[model samples]
Structures are given as C-alpha cells and as structure tokens.
Target: MTPDQATPLLDRVNLPSDLKGFSDTELRQIADELRHETISTVAETGGHLGAGLGVVELTVALHAVFNTPRDRLIWDVSHQCYPHKILTGRRPRAKTLRKGGGLSGFTKRSESPYDPFGAAHSSTSISAALGFAVARDLGASPEHGLGDVIAVIGDGAISAGMAYEGLNNAGHLKKRMIVILNDNEMSIAPPTGAMSSYLSRLYAGAPFQEFKAAAKGAVSLLPEPFQEGARRAKELVKSVTVGGTLFEELGFSYIGPIDGHDMEQLLNVLRTVKARADGPVLIHAITRKGKGYAPAEQAKDKGHATAKFDPATGEQKKAPSNAPSYTRVFADYLIREAEADPLITAVTAAMPSGTGLNLFAERFPDRTFDVGIAEQHGVTFCAGMAAGGLKPFCALYSTFLQRGYDQVVHDVAIQRLPVRFAIDRAGLVGADGPTHAGSFDIAFLANLPDFVVMAAADEAELAHMVATAASIDDRPSAFRFPRGEGVGVEMPERGTPLEIGKGRIVREGSRVAILSFGARLSECLRAAENLAARGITPTIADARFAKPLDQNLIRDLATNHEALITIEEGAVGGFGSHVAQFLSDEGLLDTGLKFRSMVFPDTFIDHDSPASMYAAAAMNAPDIEAKVLKVLDIASLAAERRA
Candidate 1:
C-alpha cells in the first residue's frame, strides 16, 4: 500500500486479525499511516503524543510478528499504546480518544481482546507478561502448545525496582518470554539512578565486544574433560565482568542496544531473537521519545503530555481567558516557599514537570532531587532528609504514590517523619483513565497512623495546604490536588496554615448538608445553588482533611441538617468511607438521619474529560443535586398523592 492507500487500509483495519492478511511491506506502510493518525488524533485530543509517536513502528512490527489476542502483549505504563489501539480495532474511535464513552488512553483489556494485559503504572508490564506466560505454560505442556508473551517496557520504566524484580524472576525461571526495552532515556522526565547510568553505559558501548571476546577466550581456555565446567565458569566470569550484570545473572539472554526506529534492523533483530530464544530475552532498543514531530522532539520533556495543538505548526490552541493550572499554582507556591526557606528541599519520582516541581527545581537546583520512577525510594529518601533536619517536599502523582504506599507507612508515618507529600493528580485524571486516577490515595494514606492527609478544594486551598504541610513538623503530612486549571478564584499571596482537624462552612443552610472534599467543591457549590432554587437551602462545607476527620463539624452538620451527603473525587474507600466509619463509630447512623455518600462508582472509569468523568461517576453538580434531593425526601414528596 502506498501512503494514500495506507490511510484507507488502516481505516478498514479495526482489529489485529484484520492486519494478518496484509504483507510485511504493506504493514510497514500501515505503520507510517498509523503514526500520522496518532499524531493527528493526539493533536486533537492532546495526550501522551510523543511516546505513542515513538512506538508506532514497534507496534506494527510486534503485531505483524506476534499472534496478538493469543499471544499476550503487555505494554508498560501503556502511554505508548495509541498505535496498538489503532491497529487493534479502535481506529474509528481514535478521534474520540480520552473523551467520555470513547477509546481508552491506555491499554485496556476490556477495550480490545488484543490488549491482553492492561497497565498504566510504569514497570508493571514485564511482571504481568511473566504472570500470563506462567499461566500459559501451566495450561500447556510439551505435547500441547503455548502462545508467546511479550512485554514492551521503556528504559525509564526499567529504573523502577519492580521491573528488575520481574526481570529477576523471569530470568530465574528461564521462561520463554520476550521483553522489549523501549529506551527513550525518559520517564516523563530524564531518568536517574545507578541502573539508568548502567543502561547509559550499555548505550555508550561499554563492554559488548569485550564481554563477547572474553566469553570466546574462556571457552578456548577449557580443558577437554572440564568443558561443561568451563562453560559455567565462562558464564560466571561474563556476569562478573559486566559489573554486577543483573539481567544475565538472573539468566536472561540479553540482546541489542539496537536502533528502535530503524525498521529493518528492529525487524531482523526481533525475528532472529524470536527464532533462537530458548530462555527469556531482553531486547534493548534505543529510540527518541518524540521520533517524528520536530517540535515534540525539541521539547524539554519530549512533549510527555500536551494540550490539543495544530498539526501543521505543533502549537497548542489557547483557551479563552485561561486561569493558572493547579500544577502551575503548586509550582509557583513551592518556588516561593523554597525561596523563603533554604531548608525546603523538593523531590519527585521522575516527575519534576508533572508534579509541578520544575519551578522549585529551577529556583533551588541544589535542593531538588528527581529520584526517577522510584517512588518507594523517593518517599524514604524524603524521610531520611527530614530526619537529617531538612524540610523535604516529596511531590508525586496520586496514582504513582500507590507504588510507595508501604514506604509512606513504614518509613515516614511509622517514624513520624515530617515529609510533606505534595500529591498531584488527586482525582479522575482526564484522558489517562482509572489507572492514572488519584482514587485510592486518600483512603490508603488517610488510614495510616501518624499520617495527616489533606485534599485541596481549589488552587487557593492547595496553596494553603502546601503551607500547612510545610508548617507541620510533628508527623508526615500529604496534600492532594486534582489535575487541570484552577476554578478562577481570588489569589492568595501567602498561604496561611489552617487549624488541623477542622473544616469550614462555605455556605450556611438548613434541611440538607453537602460535605465536599478536594476538587469536587465547585460541583457541590453548584449543586447547593440548584437546591436553593428549589427552596431547599443546602449547607456546603469543604472538608479539607480526609484524615483526622473534622468530627466537630461533621457532628454539627449531621445534628443540624435533616439530610447529609458526602462528595469526593475518589472511589469507595476515600472521604465517603471515612465519613461512614466516623458516623458509625459515633452512633450517628442509628439516629434516623438520612445520609448518602457521593463518590466514584466501584468500577474502572475509562479515559474522558475530567468533567465528563465526574458526571459519569455521579460526582457532578446535577447528579449531586439529584442525590441530595432524593436523600432529603423532596423527590419522594413531589411524587406523593395530593391531599
């Protein structure tokens, strides 16, 4: 297929099985077309554009070679699955990417049969692939047949300990699995650590020839009687000389620092490895993050994520009268605080730009640390900093923080270390979907002893929360804020620390009380306004702290109002669950007080706009209003027989 023909060919291929009929040359043409589609789609939807662009050729090569659906393909972090999605039956819906009821932004098993294993968190693909490989082996035998298991991971993802753990296990088992290391030298930001350095050395031609020569020399050195012994000895020497080479030691037949973008090289290498690989194989392919687009390639963070832009100019379309994003606001405040206090040190898990710590890093370069995808290390590292008398701000995404939960509980909370967690993306992240949603952090962190969890109602509150976290020195504290621009509110020059375990009434009313937490406060306010129009004044309170529940305020609200509701931008175990637990403990539930909790439904919400997702989850104004009216018996009374 030619370029024009390739477009129509791709348009017709909505499933991987459909591509089976196409020739390899035709498939390559389809890849080019897919890249074009992905770039155009992302230009409209505005997501992880560069990564997807980088993986287009790889995606085509993998699907063409492997029998997908039968052969499990797990994409680590899954930010680069746009091409895969396009090839696997979601092509028509590409334009609706990240919108409500549209295709997912990440690999989703429910989205397509070809997406055997889903992932959003980094470094999980290899482990997941190993699990599927094990399952397939267990189901099959030497007489039976088993399908291939491929894990397409990134170089940045390999920085995480979990990927190493998977690699170690896969190597130890000698599983017939393939791990494609997509090395772009980035993970939202430039990767760090000894592993990253090692990979960099491999990229720089440290010992490839030397190791091969040594192995050949060792084989020649063996006596006739001790040939087997010499073979084992050679393996041991090769492992050692590689500077504690973990992958080879673990037993993986490692191959290539090959060019990922070079189609011919990638295909030949992949085919060769697939044909002769008995044990596990790790293919290290180096490619640019934003391979095709010059603007994205030239971007500081490789256009990790973006707003909708023009395809011709690669310029983001400006919004009408845009307010400061929550991230920008946080970044600005962090910088201001760092400037005021020299002891204020900021840390992020390879997300300086994402967590709004880029400004802080810029202003206080000496104090900023990008720990790379190691969230567990980032948390404990921050704890160590705090113990050493430095104020450490551990900024991380709420979803990514899940990776460091144990560390947060064990290292920080257990020790009562004053490590301030600046948790960004604390709610349903638009486009990124459930895996990236900041749903469980509140519930997970709030439950821990010696931990203070606060969720900002808006950007102004986020500033105050940051100050509060900085001010609190007795125990570990975290402040979570949602993604996207702040609701245009008056700015505060300096953040004032609020009294702990306290909440404020935003609007005083009777009959019904709406307890709003995090970014859902605006929705609650809107709901309150709607209720007021119906002659039902609803009390609105911003319960800032998810942990250390404002018992006094909650009890008062329950006592005063005939009906009570709790609203939050999280799943079941978050603010609503805490409120239920509190009410149950206080014997408030038995008082015949009508109550309802408005939280994210117990399901994995797909990629969409934040507003649309909230609305779908019934956490929006109209839904909240409807629920509040129902709880107040207003809806029921309106339906009753007239006297």
Candidate 2:
C-alpha cells in the first residue's frame, strides 16, 4: 500500500507546498509513514531501499523548510530520492519504479520540475547546487526562479575531490546556499579514505548525555525545553576530535553533527538555518544507512539495493541462475592468476563487492585497494603500481571509468604502463538506466594507441581474457564483460590465453556471415538458427579483440560471404566502425559485398530489461536475422520470383 493510503497526514501532501502548514509533530508522523511506504514500495519493485529509509526524516524536513522546484533541491547520487519522489506527486507510480516506462531509479530533470538536477553518479550534487546558486544570482534560469539551492550530499560523496572543489568554489563566491551533509557512515560499500575518518571525528562523544549535563550556557542557543538535553549535545560537539573549523576556514557557517533521525531536532535545526543562513552553510546530520526498518538495517549492504522482496523477512525474490555470473567468473579467474603471480594487485574506485574485487581483497588483502569514489585517483594509482613493476588490475565499471578517462590517457596509455583495465557492466545495464550504461568505453579506449581492447563473448571467453591480461605485461590492456550471468559455456579448469588480435569461427556457413563482438555471440547463433530454418545458413564468428581487429578473420568473412553484418553491444564507432574502416583501407568493400554494422542505436537508451533494451537497439536475434535478410535482398528476390 502507498504512504497516503496508510497515513492520513501524508495523504494531504500532494506537493512540497502542501507541507507548508505541517507542524513538527505532523511532519514526524508523515516521516514514519514515508519510511513504511518506501519499505513497502521497494519490497514490491526493489530498488535503493536503505538510502531512502535513512533520508525519510531529512526528506520531510527539507520539503517542510525549503521551497522546492522554485528553490533547487538536488540529491547527491539521487539513490536516496525515493521518499522525495513519493512526496512530490509520484506516489501513485512508485510501484512501477525502475521498470520500462516507469519512474527512474534516480532523479530525472524530465520526470518532474521538483527534480531541478538529475544525478546517478556521486559527488556531483555539491557542484550542481553551487551552479544553481550562481545561476539564481545571475538570473539565468528565470523559469525556475531559483532561491536557496540545497545539496543533500552523503558522507561518502564528500570523499571525492569534486565535492571539495565545489565546496571551495562555493565558499569563495559566498552564495546563499545550503549543503546538508547526510553523514550516514555508509555508501554502497562502507566508506573508505581520510574523509570518513574525519567525519567520524566530527561526532566522537556521546552527544545527548553531554548536552544534558552542560545545560546552561552551551545549550542556550537551542529551544528552551531542549536546552538541558541539547547542552550535552553542544558540549559533545565542542569536545569533537576534530573541529568543524576546517569548514569555517572554507568560509561556510558550520552547524550540526546532529541527529538526522530525530524529527523535532531536524525541524528545529533546519528551521533555524533556513531563517538565518546568509552564505553557504553546511549542516552535518548524522544518520544510519538503514534507519527505521529492522530488516534493512540488518542487511549486509544495509539494503543499498535489492530485487523484489518479502517486506517482513527481507528475503529477496531473485530468478535462479543457469550459470555463474560474469562478475564471479572474472573474480575467480583473477584470483587464480594472482595466486601464481606475486606482482599482481587489484584496485577499485570504492566498489569492492560490486566490481567483484571483494573476493580478491579477501584472498589478497595486501594486494587489494578500494580507492574511495575517486576514479581519477584509482587509475593513476594503478599507473603508479604498474610503473613500480606491479601488474595492477584496475577493475572499474565502464561508466565510472569515464570519470578517469583523462588519467587513463595520461597516466596509463601515454606512459604505456602494463595496467590491466577490467571494465565491468560494459553494456546497457537494466534498472539503473542510461546514466550507468557503458556505451562509450569501446569507442573511447579503442581509439587510443598502445591499448589492447577485448570483449568476452561468453563466460569461458572472460576467463581466457583474464588470463590473457595477466600474461600481457608490455602495454595497457582492457577486457569488458556485461553485468549479469554468462552464456553457460563449458569452462576450462584453467584458462589458456588466446592469440592476440585473433577471433574464432563458431559456425561456418556460405551465404551470409555475422561477425559478433562481446556477449552477442549467443544472439548471433540464434539468428543463424532462424536463418537455417529459412533454408539460408549463415556463418558466425566471434571477434574477441576490438582494438586489434581480427583482420584475417574479417577479411576471410568479407571475401567468402555475399553479405557481412557486424554486431556489438555498444554505441557507433566501436567494433563495427573499426571493422568498416579496416574493410575500406584494404579495398574489401569494393567487392559486391553487402556490409552492415549493427551497434546500439545512436542514442541514450533508458532503463529496461537487458533483453528488451537490446531489442530496442535492434541487436537482438530477430533484428540480426532481419538485417541479414534485408542485406541479402531475400524478400525482394523471392517476392519477384513468386510473382
């Protein structure tokens, strides 16, 4: 059931403006209902549960204190925006979250006016809010008429250099803005690096008891009755391990290290700040990642994200897997290689479990590094390791690696470092949407010199590539694998590295040849089956290497077959474009060979099931078959003959 159905108080809140007359007690009741609703919705739809739960009270407080839409409110990462969505006229569609044509998992500018800024990546909110603040002063976005721009950033987000950069610039500009540091002490993984420790030092003492004890002069700033209890809080804050003076030095009015869950305290503090804030102010509100819901609070990732689940027990309802996931395969193969080589080390940008580096970390703790939300740093760090005579596997998601492209070019590629880039989620990832899609990596990386790019056609191919990457210690190399389960091929006990710049002929036929890259080999086979049934058997070859385009195999296919089709699960200018350029340079296209390159449609595809997404991009089995038939002019020739 929705929050409005459960609580009458929330039923009245059709918009943020509706929260205008809400009393502190009423707002608290609304928060409780919002938490339940978030839990209920996630139990059905399954998304970022813990983050939304943690920010329920904060969401209520922000809407109550500030004028949203008109006054910009941006969520860092926006993974914690479910509650905000529910409050802002999206409650009815909450059950359809992350599904095709449903509400986005993260805030979207097109989805609503309330979501002034969209975000799926972390450490971007502060910068975006600062821009909005500046824009308001300059009267740029007159349609929104922005005032009091707010960025509710998480503790983990502040660890990034971008956050600090934004903070520094905002401080210098002296804009009237608010930065709510939602210090939940947890990101997707437990936070890493110096900032997490510094935040821990900000609220070291037992605040309540200290405030209760020091009730006189220190507590005078708070409301009269709360003085006794709040005095101890002030004393506890005063006795901080490190001062908020660092923020003051940045020219921000530092406040809190306060209890984020407490509605009364949240209302009091936010109301006070709203009334008096002249320049950029930072409110550090301490919170639990999974607050209110017991099952979520007890979860391993603090219920960061989930599949549809039973609300009471928090038991996830997931489909049974036929084979091991590509992630597991990559991890196991890497571990196997690392066991043989002492020089091998692994690195990730704060995604240990997500990147499957957690397994490597467990086996070789000394060799694994989780460089917190800092992709640029992680890449350069790997470069340094490679320079120091270490085989550093810089494991990162394809999207996150984009943030480190500069470093990849400057530190790794240019220097010709033997850094192995393990790019995960290398295609259209479902649920998380276009923001997280790995569409550009193939095109971006393949263009660089001294870089060997490979895409695994199946799980077995992935293992082989891992071994291949381990063996290649001359220059930079990367191998990409998709997000979910592999194609259930018989895996070898130990991977034997394949010859570089080579591809394997899966099925040989005469009429038309389909050259496949990455995991689309299965679909190519399926297309072959369809064509075979129609009395036209097609040849299929898996071009494992994208950069060192299997020239011999590509040349053979073009020469033998009347029609040739190249398919990859990436944007244009990737495998297909490279192949086209090769054929042109070699004068192969001068022959009467029908050539077609089927890549992802030249656009950002939205969130949908992987199969459906591929279909939309016209790279599925049927699409492949259609491309072959059209290129061969089978339908036209047959129809003319029949007539």
Candidate 3:
C-alpha cells in the first residue's frame, strides 16, 4: 500500500528515522495502526500473522528508541518482522509477502539496511547480535554504521541450545548489548508485583556509577554463592522480586517480566536499557501472540499462518480439495499401522500439525512425541526408541531433517537402527519458498550406506511405502512425499508392503523410457500421453526405491529402449545421479545408450506457485515431454514442424 493510503501516523512515517518525531502517545497510535496494517496485509498475502501482531508495540518501541540501521536491531526467527518491515520503508510491498519477486516473509539482508541479519529458522539471533556489538566496539567502518546491538528473541526461540550459547558468550564478554525476550507465553500481569517494578525503575532512574553496586546487588540475578556476598547490599530492597536467574547465571543482567503491550512501560524499559546497560541484559517483555485482533487471539496457533481470508470474520478462503493432502494420507495410514502394532510410535521436531502427526497424537497421545524446535534431539530419540525394540517413526519436514544430518549419520545410520523416517514436503513447497523446500533429502538419505530410501509416486504409493518401512525392522528406511493434496487417487483401506528394492512398471512402451523416483511420476505419465498423441510411446516406471537401484528393471530398460531418462523432484545429486552411476558401472553406458537425467536445476528457486516453480526448474509435464523428444533426437524437427 502507498504511504498516502495508510493511517495518518504511518503515512508520514516512511522509515525508523520518521518515528523520532512522534511523541510516546503518538508512537502508541503508530503501533496500533501498524497492527491493523499488518493484519490487512497478511489477510490478502497469506503469510505469518500472529507473530507480527504480537510484536507490533515492541517493533515501534525499538525503532523509536534506538537508532536503527546503525543500532543493528535483530529479530529471532524474524517471522515477527512484518511490522518492522513496514516502519523501515517496505510498506508498499507488504501485501506481496512470500510471493514470487516480492518481499520475503522473514527478514532479509538484501531487502533492507535495517535487516542486518537474515533469519528464517529459529535460535540464531543472540549470536548475530553479539557479533554486531563486537564489530562496533572494534571500530569497524561500514556504510550502515553501528551502535548498541539488540536481539529481540521470543520465549519459544530462546529455549534452543544455540541461544544459550550466545548468551553464555555475551555474558563472558560483558558487551553493551540487549537481548529482549519477547515472552508471549507468559501472562501480561507479571507475578513480580508493583514493588519489584518500582525497584527496577529506581535502578534505571539513578546515574550509572552512583548506583552501579547497589543496582547489581538489588536486581542483578547473581548465582547463589554470589548472592550471599550481596546480602548486606540487597537488604534495602526487601521483598523485591525478579525473574530469569538462568540468564543471570549465564552472565547477563536479567530484567523485567514487564507488560510488553503497555506502550509507556515498553518505552520506559527500552529507553532505560539503551542508556544504562554496560553488560549483556535480557529484558523479559511479556506479550501475547495475536494480541489485538479478536479472531486471531481466539484461534489456535494464534492464527500463525493463514490463507487469503475475510478480514472481518477471519474466515480462510482456501480452495476446496477433492483429495486428502499428502500429510493427511500419511497421518491416517500411520494411525492404522499403530492400531495393529503396539510398538509403533511417532516423533516430530516442533512441527506436529505441519507433519500431520497431530492426528496421530490424537489417536495415540502416549505414543507420540513433539520435540520442540530440536531436530537433532528428535532424530537421536527415535534411534534410541528403535534400539529399545520400538518401531519409531521420526516424522519431520525434509528441510528440517537437514538440521539433524550428523545425528542421522552417527546415531541412526551408523548404528543401523530401525528408524522409520516419514519425510514430508519433499519437493518445491509454494509460498514458503526455497528456505522451506524439501529438495535435498533424497540425495542425502539415498547416499547413506545400508539405508533404505523410498519416494511415493502418489498418495496410495505413500501408504504402501509407509507399510514397507514398518516391515523393515533391521535397518533405517525413509519415504518422501510432496506438499498439498494427492492427485485424487483412491486410498487403500489398509496399506500392503512392497518387496525391498523393487520397482513397478506404470506403462509399457517402445523406443525410449522415463523412469521416475518420486511424486514427478504423475508429470511423467502426463508427458507420456503427449508423446503417445505424437505417435511415440515411452515406457514409464516408478523406481520406488532410490537406493538398491532396481537392478533388473534398470538393466531391462537400458537394453530394450534406445533412450532411458531418469527423473525425480529432487536436486541433481539424488535418484537420477545414482541411476547414472549404476548404468556407467554396469557397462550399460558403453552400448551407445542415450542416457539423460532430469532433476531440479542447480539453483535456489524463489517463492512462487508450485506449478510456476516447477516450470522454472524445467520439471513440469511439458519440460518432461521436451526432454523425451530431445533424448530421442527429434527436438529440432519437432520445433521446426511446430514453426
């Protein structure tokens, strides 16, 4: 939206510098308007809503108090950065969030000077903030300049180990930095009574040197041994309370449990810290996710993500689906499997709903685990369960599974544990873009020795694969599937297990062949129809297992067909690459066979519609047809005929 069309305060405020002229009361108004603007923008664009809404006041207060672009204000995870983006000259493109060629849903360094550190995944902001502070103290010269560094991390994000690592280091360095814990999970009314607030205010009210010792004794969260030393010093501030001793133990001067929504309190706390802090300080500002909007506040997940919705009623305008989503299919099948097998259990790293494990959890709550934002722990935990003779399904997004790669290698793969990895979002996901794409799992998992890697051709195939993985009790196995609904294929009442390392022929043909390893089988079949209309019938096969190579099926295709093409919805080093290696090692390449590998292009595709992204990667149906024609040495002739 144009600055002219927005509310009075936002219209005048194009940048954080513009916030300087606004009074505290006016700043509160700007925050309120910014919240409305955020809701309206996300209602149209369908990006993260709740996190941004929660931080509307905090966003305004930070900018209004600090000299941003110079101060290096960082947001943890940055899903809450929409309001920050609006105050930093990105309001015009706010409605285009997560769209192709538009603003990112999270903070991006390339997008604006205010976004000094880019983040999508959680728990890295504290470290980045400290780096900036160290740089400023060392007199590093840059165009954006440098001042006091602040990392606004949420309570959920602060739970990760990496955040504590940054905190431990920062406390040791004693740098002049701020790490505001956006404590949305807490109540707005702090348990620490009015008396504690008065003491903190007094600490902030006094000059630095005069009250430094007294302030540290009173409000500084010291270790128990150190607290005894301050016993006499702390006696004046009797019955005063403060939270966050863990942070203080890590070396930070912890403050607050403050009401984050109160503009006066926020401004006062922020301004005091900006002037007074000489060491790492963690300000716990208690706010609520989906704070202002009633619909959002009441909804589960606090309306974290939404489709295009009616702003008044908060009703999503999603297109009706004829088929159950891939996630849903997996969940239902897993529940059925768990019904028969008492040993079957599931685990997901903070993505219960996204992976559809929430449904499974509802069926068997005791058998389900939601390890919060910790993929490494989730993977190892599954490995342990398997070791204890339990059938553990480590369900995780293909992108998030990357976080636990080392654990997979050491704890699972090397140990040869029977961990069934239900990998979801195994292709180009729409809206979330490259950061969330499941483009690498097949390549990484298939390359591991003694690992059984499979990809479902469709929802029915996904069902079968789930059963197959369950039966493989001696070794680790994984099956990948894409996002969104299946291709309206009829679901099986119960899945039947397929033989290990075997593939199935989808259609018989002549001259050339298209062997698919994943969800792209549908595209391959569509391309074959186009080829058949043109009097060329290509053999199509679903190479269910990426590893184990389906040697007999592969050899037969290479010997029978003049051309053999392998395609998958993965990056270059996955199924297709493995096939090429096998064909070469088996002396099949020496027989003048025209071999081609069709995979995602070697680049990070930006956010777009899934169809558009597939087209950009040249893996859509027409691209498949073109690959077939070119491999058959008829592409130029086909082009000439069309011309």
Candidate 4:
C-alpha cells in the first residue's frame, strides 16, 4: 500500500495538539503513518532520511505526552527533526525540505516557535536544554515560557566532550531536566570508543527488572510500585560495574535501554517521566537507525543522506558527475603519499567517510584513528604523534576544526609540531547553510604563527597542496578545498611538492591584474574574458598560499598593472585581507593602482545552489566583472555591458 493510504489517522492531525484526544491504539496508528510520511517526504525532497524514521514513534510519544513549544524540546544535531517538524504545523511545507527558500533540514529557532534553540552541529542539545531549564525556574519570559526542557541526543553525539561537560554541569546544578540518549548503535559511521561499549552492556544481560530500575533514574522520584524495580536495578549496576554507574555518579536519575520504537512503552515512559522526575534525568531509549523502511534499514549508513529517490525501490535519482569530487581527489592523493612514507598516519573526529579518511583507513588500518566525536582530543592526539616523529594528517571538515582551535595553538603551533590538517568543505557549502559553512578556517588558521595555509584552485591544485603539506615537516600546515565536484582538471600520476611561498601567474595581461585564491580562479578567468570583450585584457594570477603572501608575485602585479583585484572564496579576514595588508604596508596603494578586494559580505549567506550562493556573496564571475569595471571607472558610461 502507498504511504498516503497508510496514513489515514495522520490525515486528521495537523498539529501535536490533535493527538491529545486520541487513544493509545489510535496513537500507534498515527506513529505508523508518521513513519511512512517521513519516508515518502524524504524520498521526494532528498535529505536526512534514516534519522527521522528511527525517531517516528519517539516523536509521537513525546509530542503526545508532553507539552511542546511550552516544554522546549531540543534535538541534538537535529537531522532527526523531520518527524517532529511534520507534526508541528510544518507538514504542508515538508516537501520543500533543503531546497532554496524551504524548510531547513535541521531545526532552526527562527523557523518556528516549536524549535526553541537552533542546531546543526552535534552534541549541543544537552547544554542548551539545561540553560532553558534554569531560565524556566528563574521566571524568564520567552516566546513559549520555558517548561520542562528535553534534549534528545544521539549515541554518537553523546560521545563528544561537550555532551559530558553538559552532563557534569547539569548533574551538579540538579535542575529538573530531561536528556534522552537515542542509542541507535550507529552515528553516520558505526559507533566507536568506550561509550558505545558501555551502552551495549546496559542491555546485554537478563536482569531486565534490575536494569529497568537502574535505567529509570532517580528511584525515589518514581511512583510507589516502580521503586522496587528501580532500587534493584541501581544495586545490580553498582555490584558488578563501576560504582552506581557513571551517570549516577554525576547525580542524575538514570533510566533505560527501553525500546524507543515501541509505542506503548514510549507513551508509558514519557508520561511517567513528565509526571515524576525532580532532578536531572537521563532516559536511554535504544533504537535502530532506519527503523521502518526496508531499503533504508538494509543499506549502509541506513540511508543516512540521500538524493531524491524512488520511494518504492529506494533508488536515488542522481546525475553522474563528469569530474571527481575534491574529497575523492584528496583521499587518492593522500593514499599515494602514505605509500611512499610509512610515518604518514591519519586521524578523524568520527568523520571517516565525510573527510575521505575511510579510503586511507582501508589501505592502512593501523595508521588510521577515528577519535569518536571529540575534535579537541583528535587535534592534541595528532600533535602528540607529530612530536613522536610521525607525520599525522588530521582530516576534519573546516567548520568542525573550529572546535580544536586551542589545541591547534597550544599543542601544534606553540610547540612547532609538524601536524598536517586536511580541511575539507571550505567556503560556502550549499543546502546545509551557514551553520555548516567553512568560511572562517582561512581567517582563523592563517593568523597563527608557524603555520602554512594553502587553498586549492582545482582538483590538480588540491593534489599539489597535499604534497606540499606532506613535505612541510618543521611547522603546522593546512590545505582547504570546497565540497562537491572539482573543475575536471587532468589527474597527475603523482603530485610533486610546490615551492614554500610562491604563486604562478595564469594569464599575462598589462591593463589590469586579477589575483584569485582557491576555486575562485575559474571565476577570475571568466571575469577576465568578460573584460576582454570590452577591449580590456586583464592579467590573472593564482594566490596559492594565503600565508607566505607570494610577495614577489603581488609586487610584480602591483608594479605592472594599472588596476589590481584580489578575490577569494572566504570571509573578510582571509586571503584578500592579507593581500590588502601587504599592499598597504608596501605603499602599493599609493601608486594610484585601482585596487579592490572581493570577499564574502559581513553577513551570513543562506542555503541555496552553489552558483546562487556565490551570487548572494557577490563573488561570482559577473560580480567580479562588475568590480573590475567599477574600479577602472568604466561602469559609469558602460560601453555595452558584456557577459
């Protein structure tokens, strides 16, 4: 049967309030419908599918039992919020998920009153929820006056250092709050580290009555009959395991290993928790990623993220790209470098596939280290490896690398360790929006002393930069590349290391010179072509290194050309800022050279197609052509504007 027919009970419910009057049997039907609806919607729109499906029953139970909007429920990472969105008055707009001007794939505070806090990154919900709980007690007035705050964090997210910090603080404060650990036994990749093993042991035994009591958290708080089971479970945990559980030691009422997908159990548990619970409580609800849909359940990653696909067959409708992605290019090149050098090791903060380190892992398993969701630990660990006379490539997304800034400074730069950082997804990534954008890495990393930073213009440039980063052994170094397909440049058999601080001129012209950093090199050429149509031939140079400045090349362009423009796919304080600083210091601006620096605007750009996003940033080819024309004083009486 089709999803629409299966969702008869769901058809009547436009909001969470609609589920209030329904019986337990009817509520179960609504949950089933919600699952099918979530699957169908994701198949059409193409986004985070499995996460939402996994939480369908849990979402229904929460919204049905507890008062949301007033209660303030926060989903960690929020990729699982699709079902929550559907039941919370966003069902009509659900089909537009992740498209331009559509509902966000993750939760956003600005989007709805239901979403009290905004989140896209992992493991932030517990802290935010605790803040709301405190604010509620202090009589803080919000859109919806803060009631009971609930943070539903995934098992993978809970492994992060921030989550433990939140748990520690929440337990110490003893503020009434709820933290639901959605243990699906999988993050984007399979679960890792000690936390995963600990969670597994929580339900491994036949002591359900005792386990239930220990898991229920705060035995004293539960109604009279439930206390016997709770006390025994607490004791059972204390007897064989670490004293009174790690969570109990933190002063929280620990409950569960409960079946998250079971509708009756979810309803009973949520209702009881809402009624009872005096201090901070943790509900451990064991779930399966991609719970209902057979295709998603069977596939790897449980169909974590997908393109628009057929709901019937679960076949994604994606067009084949002509060029390899920068991620793949980085992986292939890193593998080649590792083959030659045994000291080359890799580390990732729980993102092996996302950062292309999985390929490196397959070739050299012992050398690879997936350090769970702890970026700070990963950075320092890599620093230690470097200090021990090993070449460690710490591969992490540019946005995620911000978490390890302190380690980057103290452990790597301060000590002058040769730790190579492979920063992926640099620049304005489409769809995932500003929260995941890699706009600040260039600005943040380039300013540090004893650091070498490079931005790749294309796939070929990426390979060269990787080789260059590998060759740099005395200091910390990083290279960044954007998401999605490369510019179809020819693949080198193997990369040759580039000069330390040099840049090459791409096209030689006398009137004006266009200097670009990163993938904006293509846009610079396009701008140059447009200028040529108006009898203006411009010189183009690639600013390979953001740090070293390539002072000779900058001086040559400034000395020879009447006008100079620097462009980069980064924020204000990045490549352009450095170039402008050098020019100002050297009195290059006083030479009456028409100088302009193009960077992303001071405001955050929203989610859209990559081409559209660049247009919003005013860093596209047309924007570049316009900048040159305005600087050259040719825009005033435009001599037939050329494309």
Candidate 4 lDDT over 316-419, as tens digits, reads 99999999999999999999999999999999998899989889999999999999999999999999999999999999999999999999999999999999
Candidate 1, residues 30-149, lDDT tens digits: the string is 877888888888888888888988888898888777777777888999989888888887777888887778877888877787787778788998888888888887885333248788
RMSD of each: 4.7, 3.4, 5.7, 1.9
Which candidate model has the greater TM-score, 3 or 4? 4
lDDT of 1 at 28: 76
> Where is the poorest 10-residue window by lDDT in model 3?
186-195
Q: At residue 573, what lDDT does model 2 achieve? A: 87
Q: Name the 10 consecutive residues with the lowest summed lDDT in model 4.
A: 634-643
The residue ranges of model 4 lying beyond 4 angstroms of the native Cα positions read 1-6, 206-217, 232-238, 242-244, 636-643
Ranking by TM-score: 4, 2, 3, 1
Off by over 4 Å in 2: 1-5, 207-241, 636-643
lDDT on C-alpha atoms for all candidate structures:
0.81, 0.88, 0.85, 0.88
Of the pair 1 and 2, which is ahead by lDDT? 2
lDDT of 2 by residue, 169-233 (tens): 99999998899999989999999998898887666657543242232221323456765665555
Clashes of 2: 5
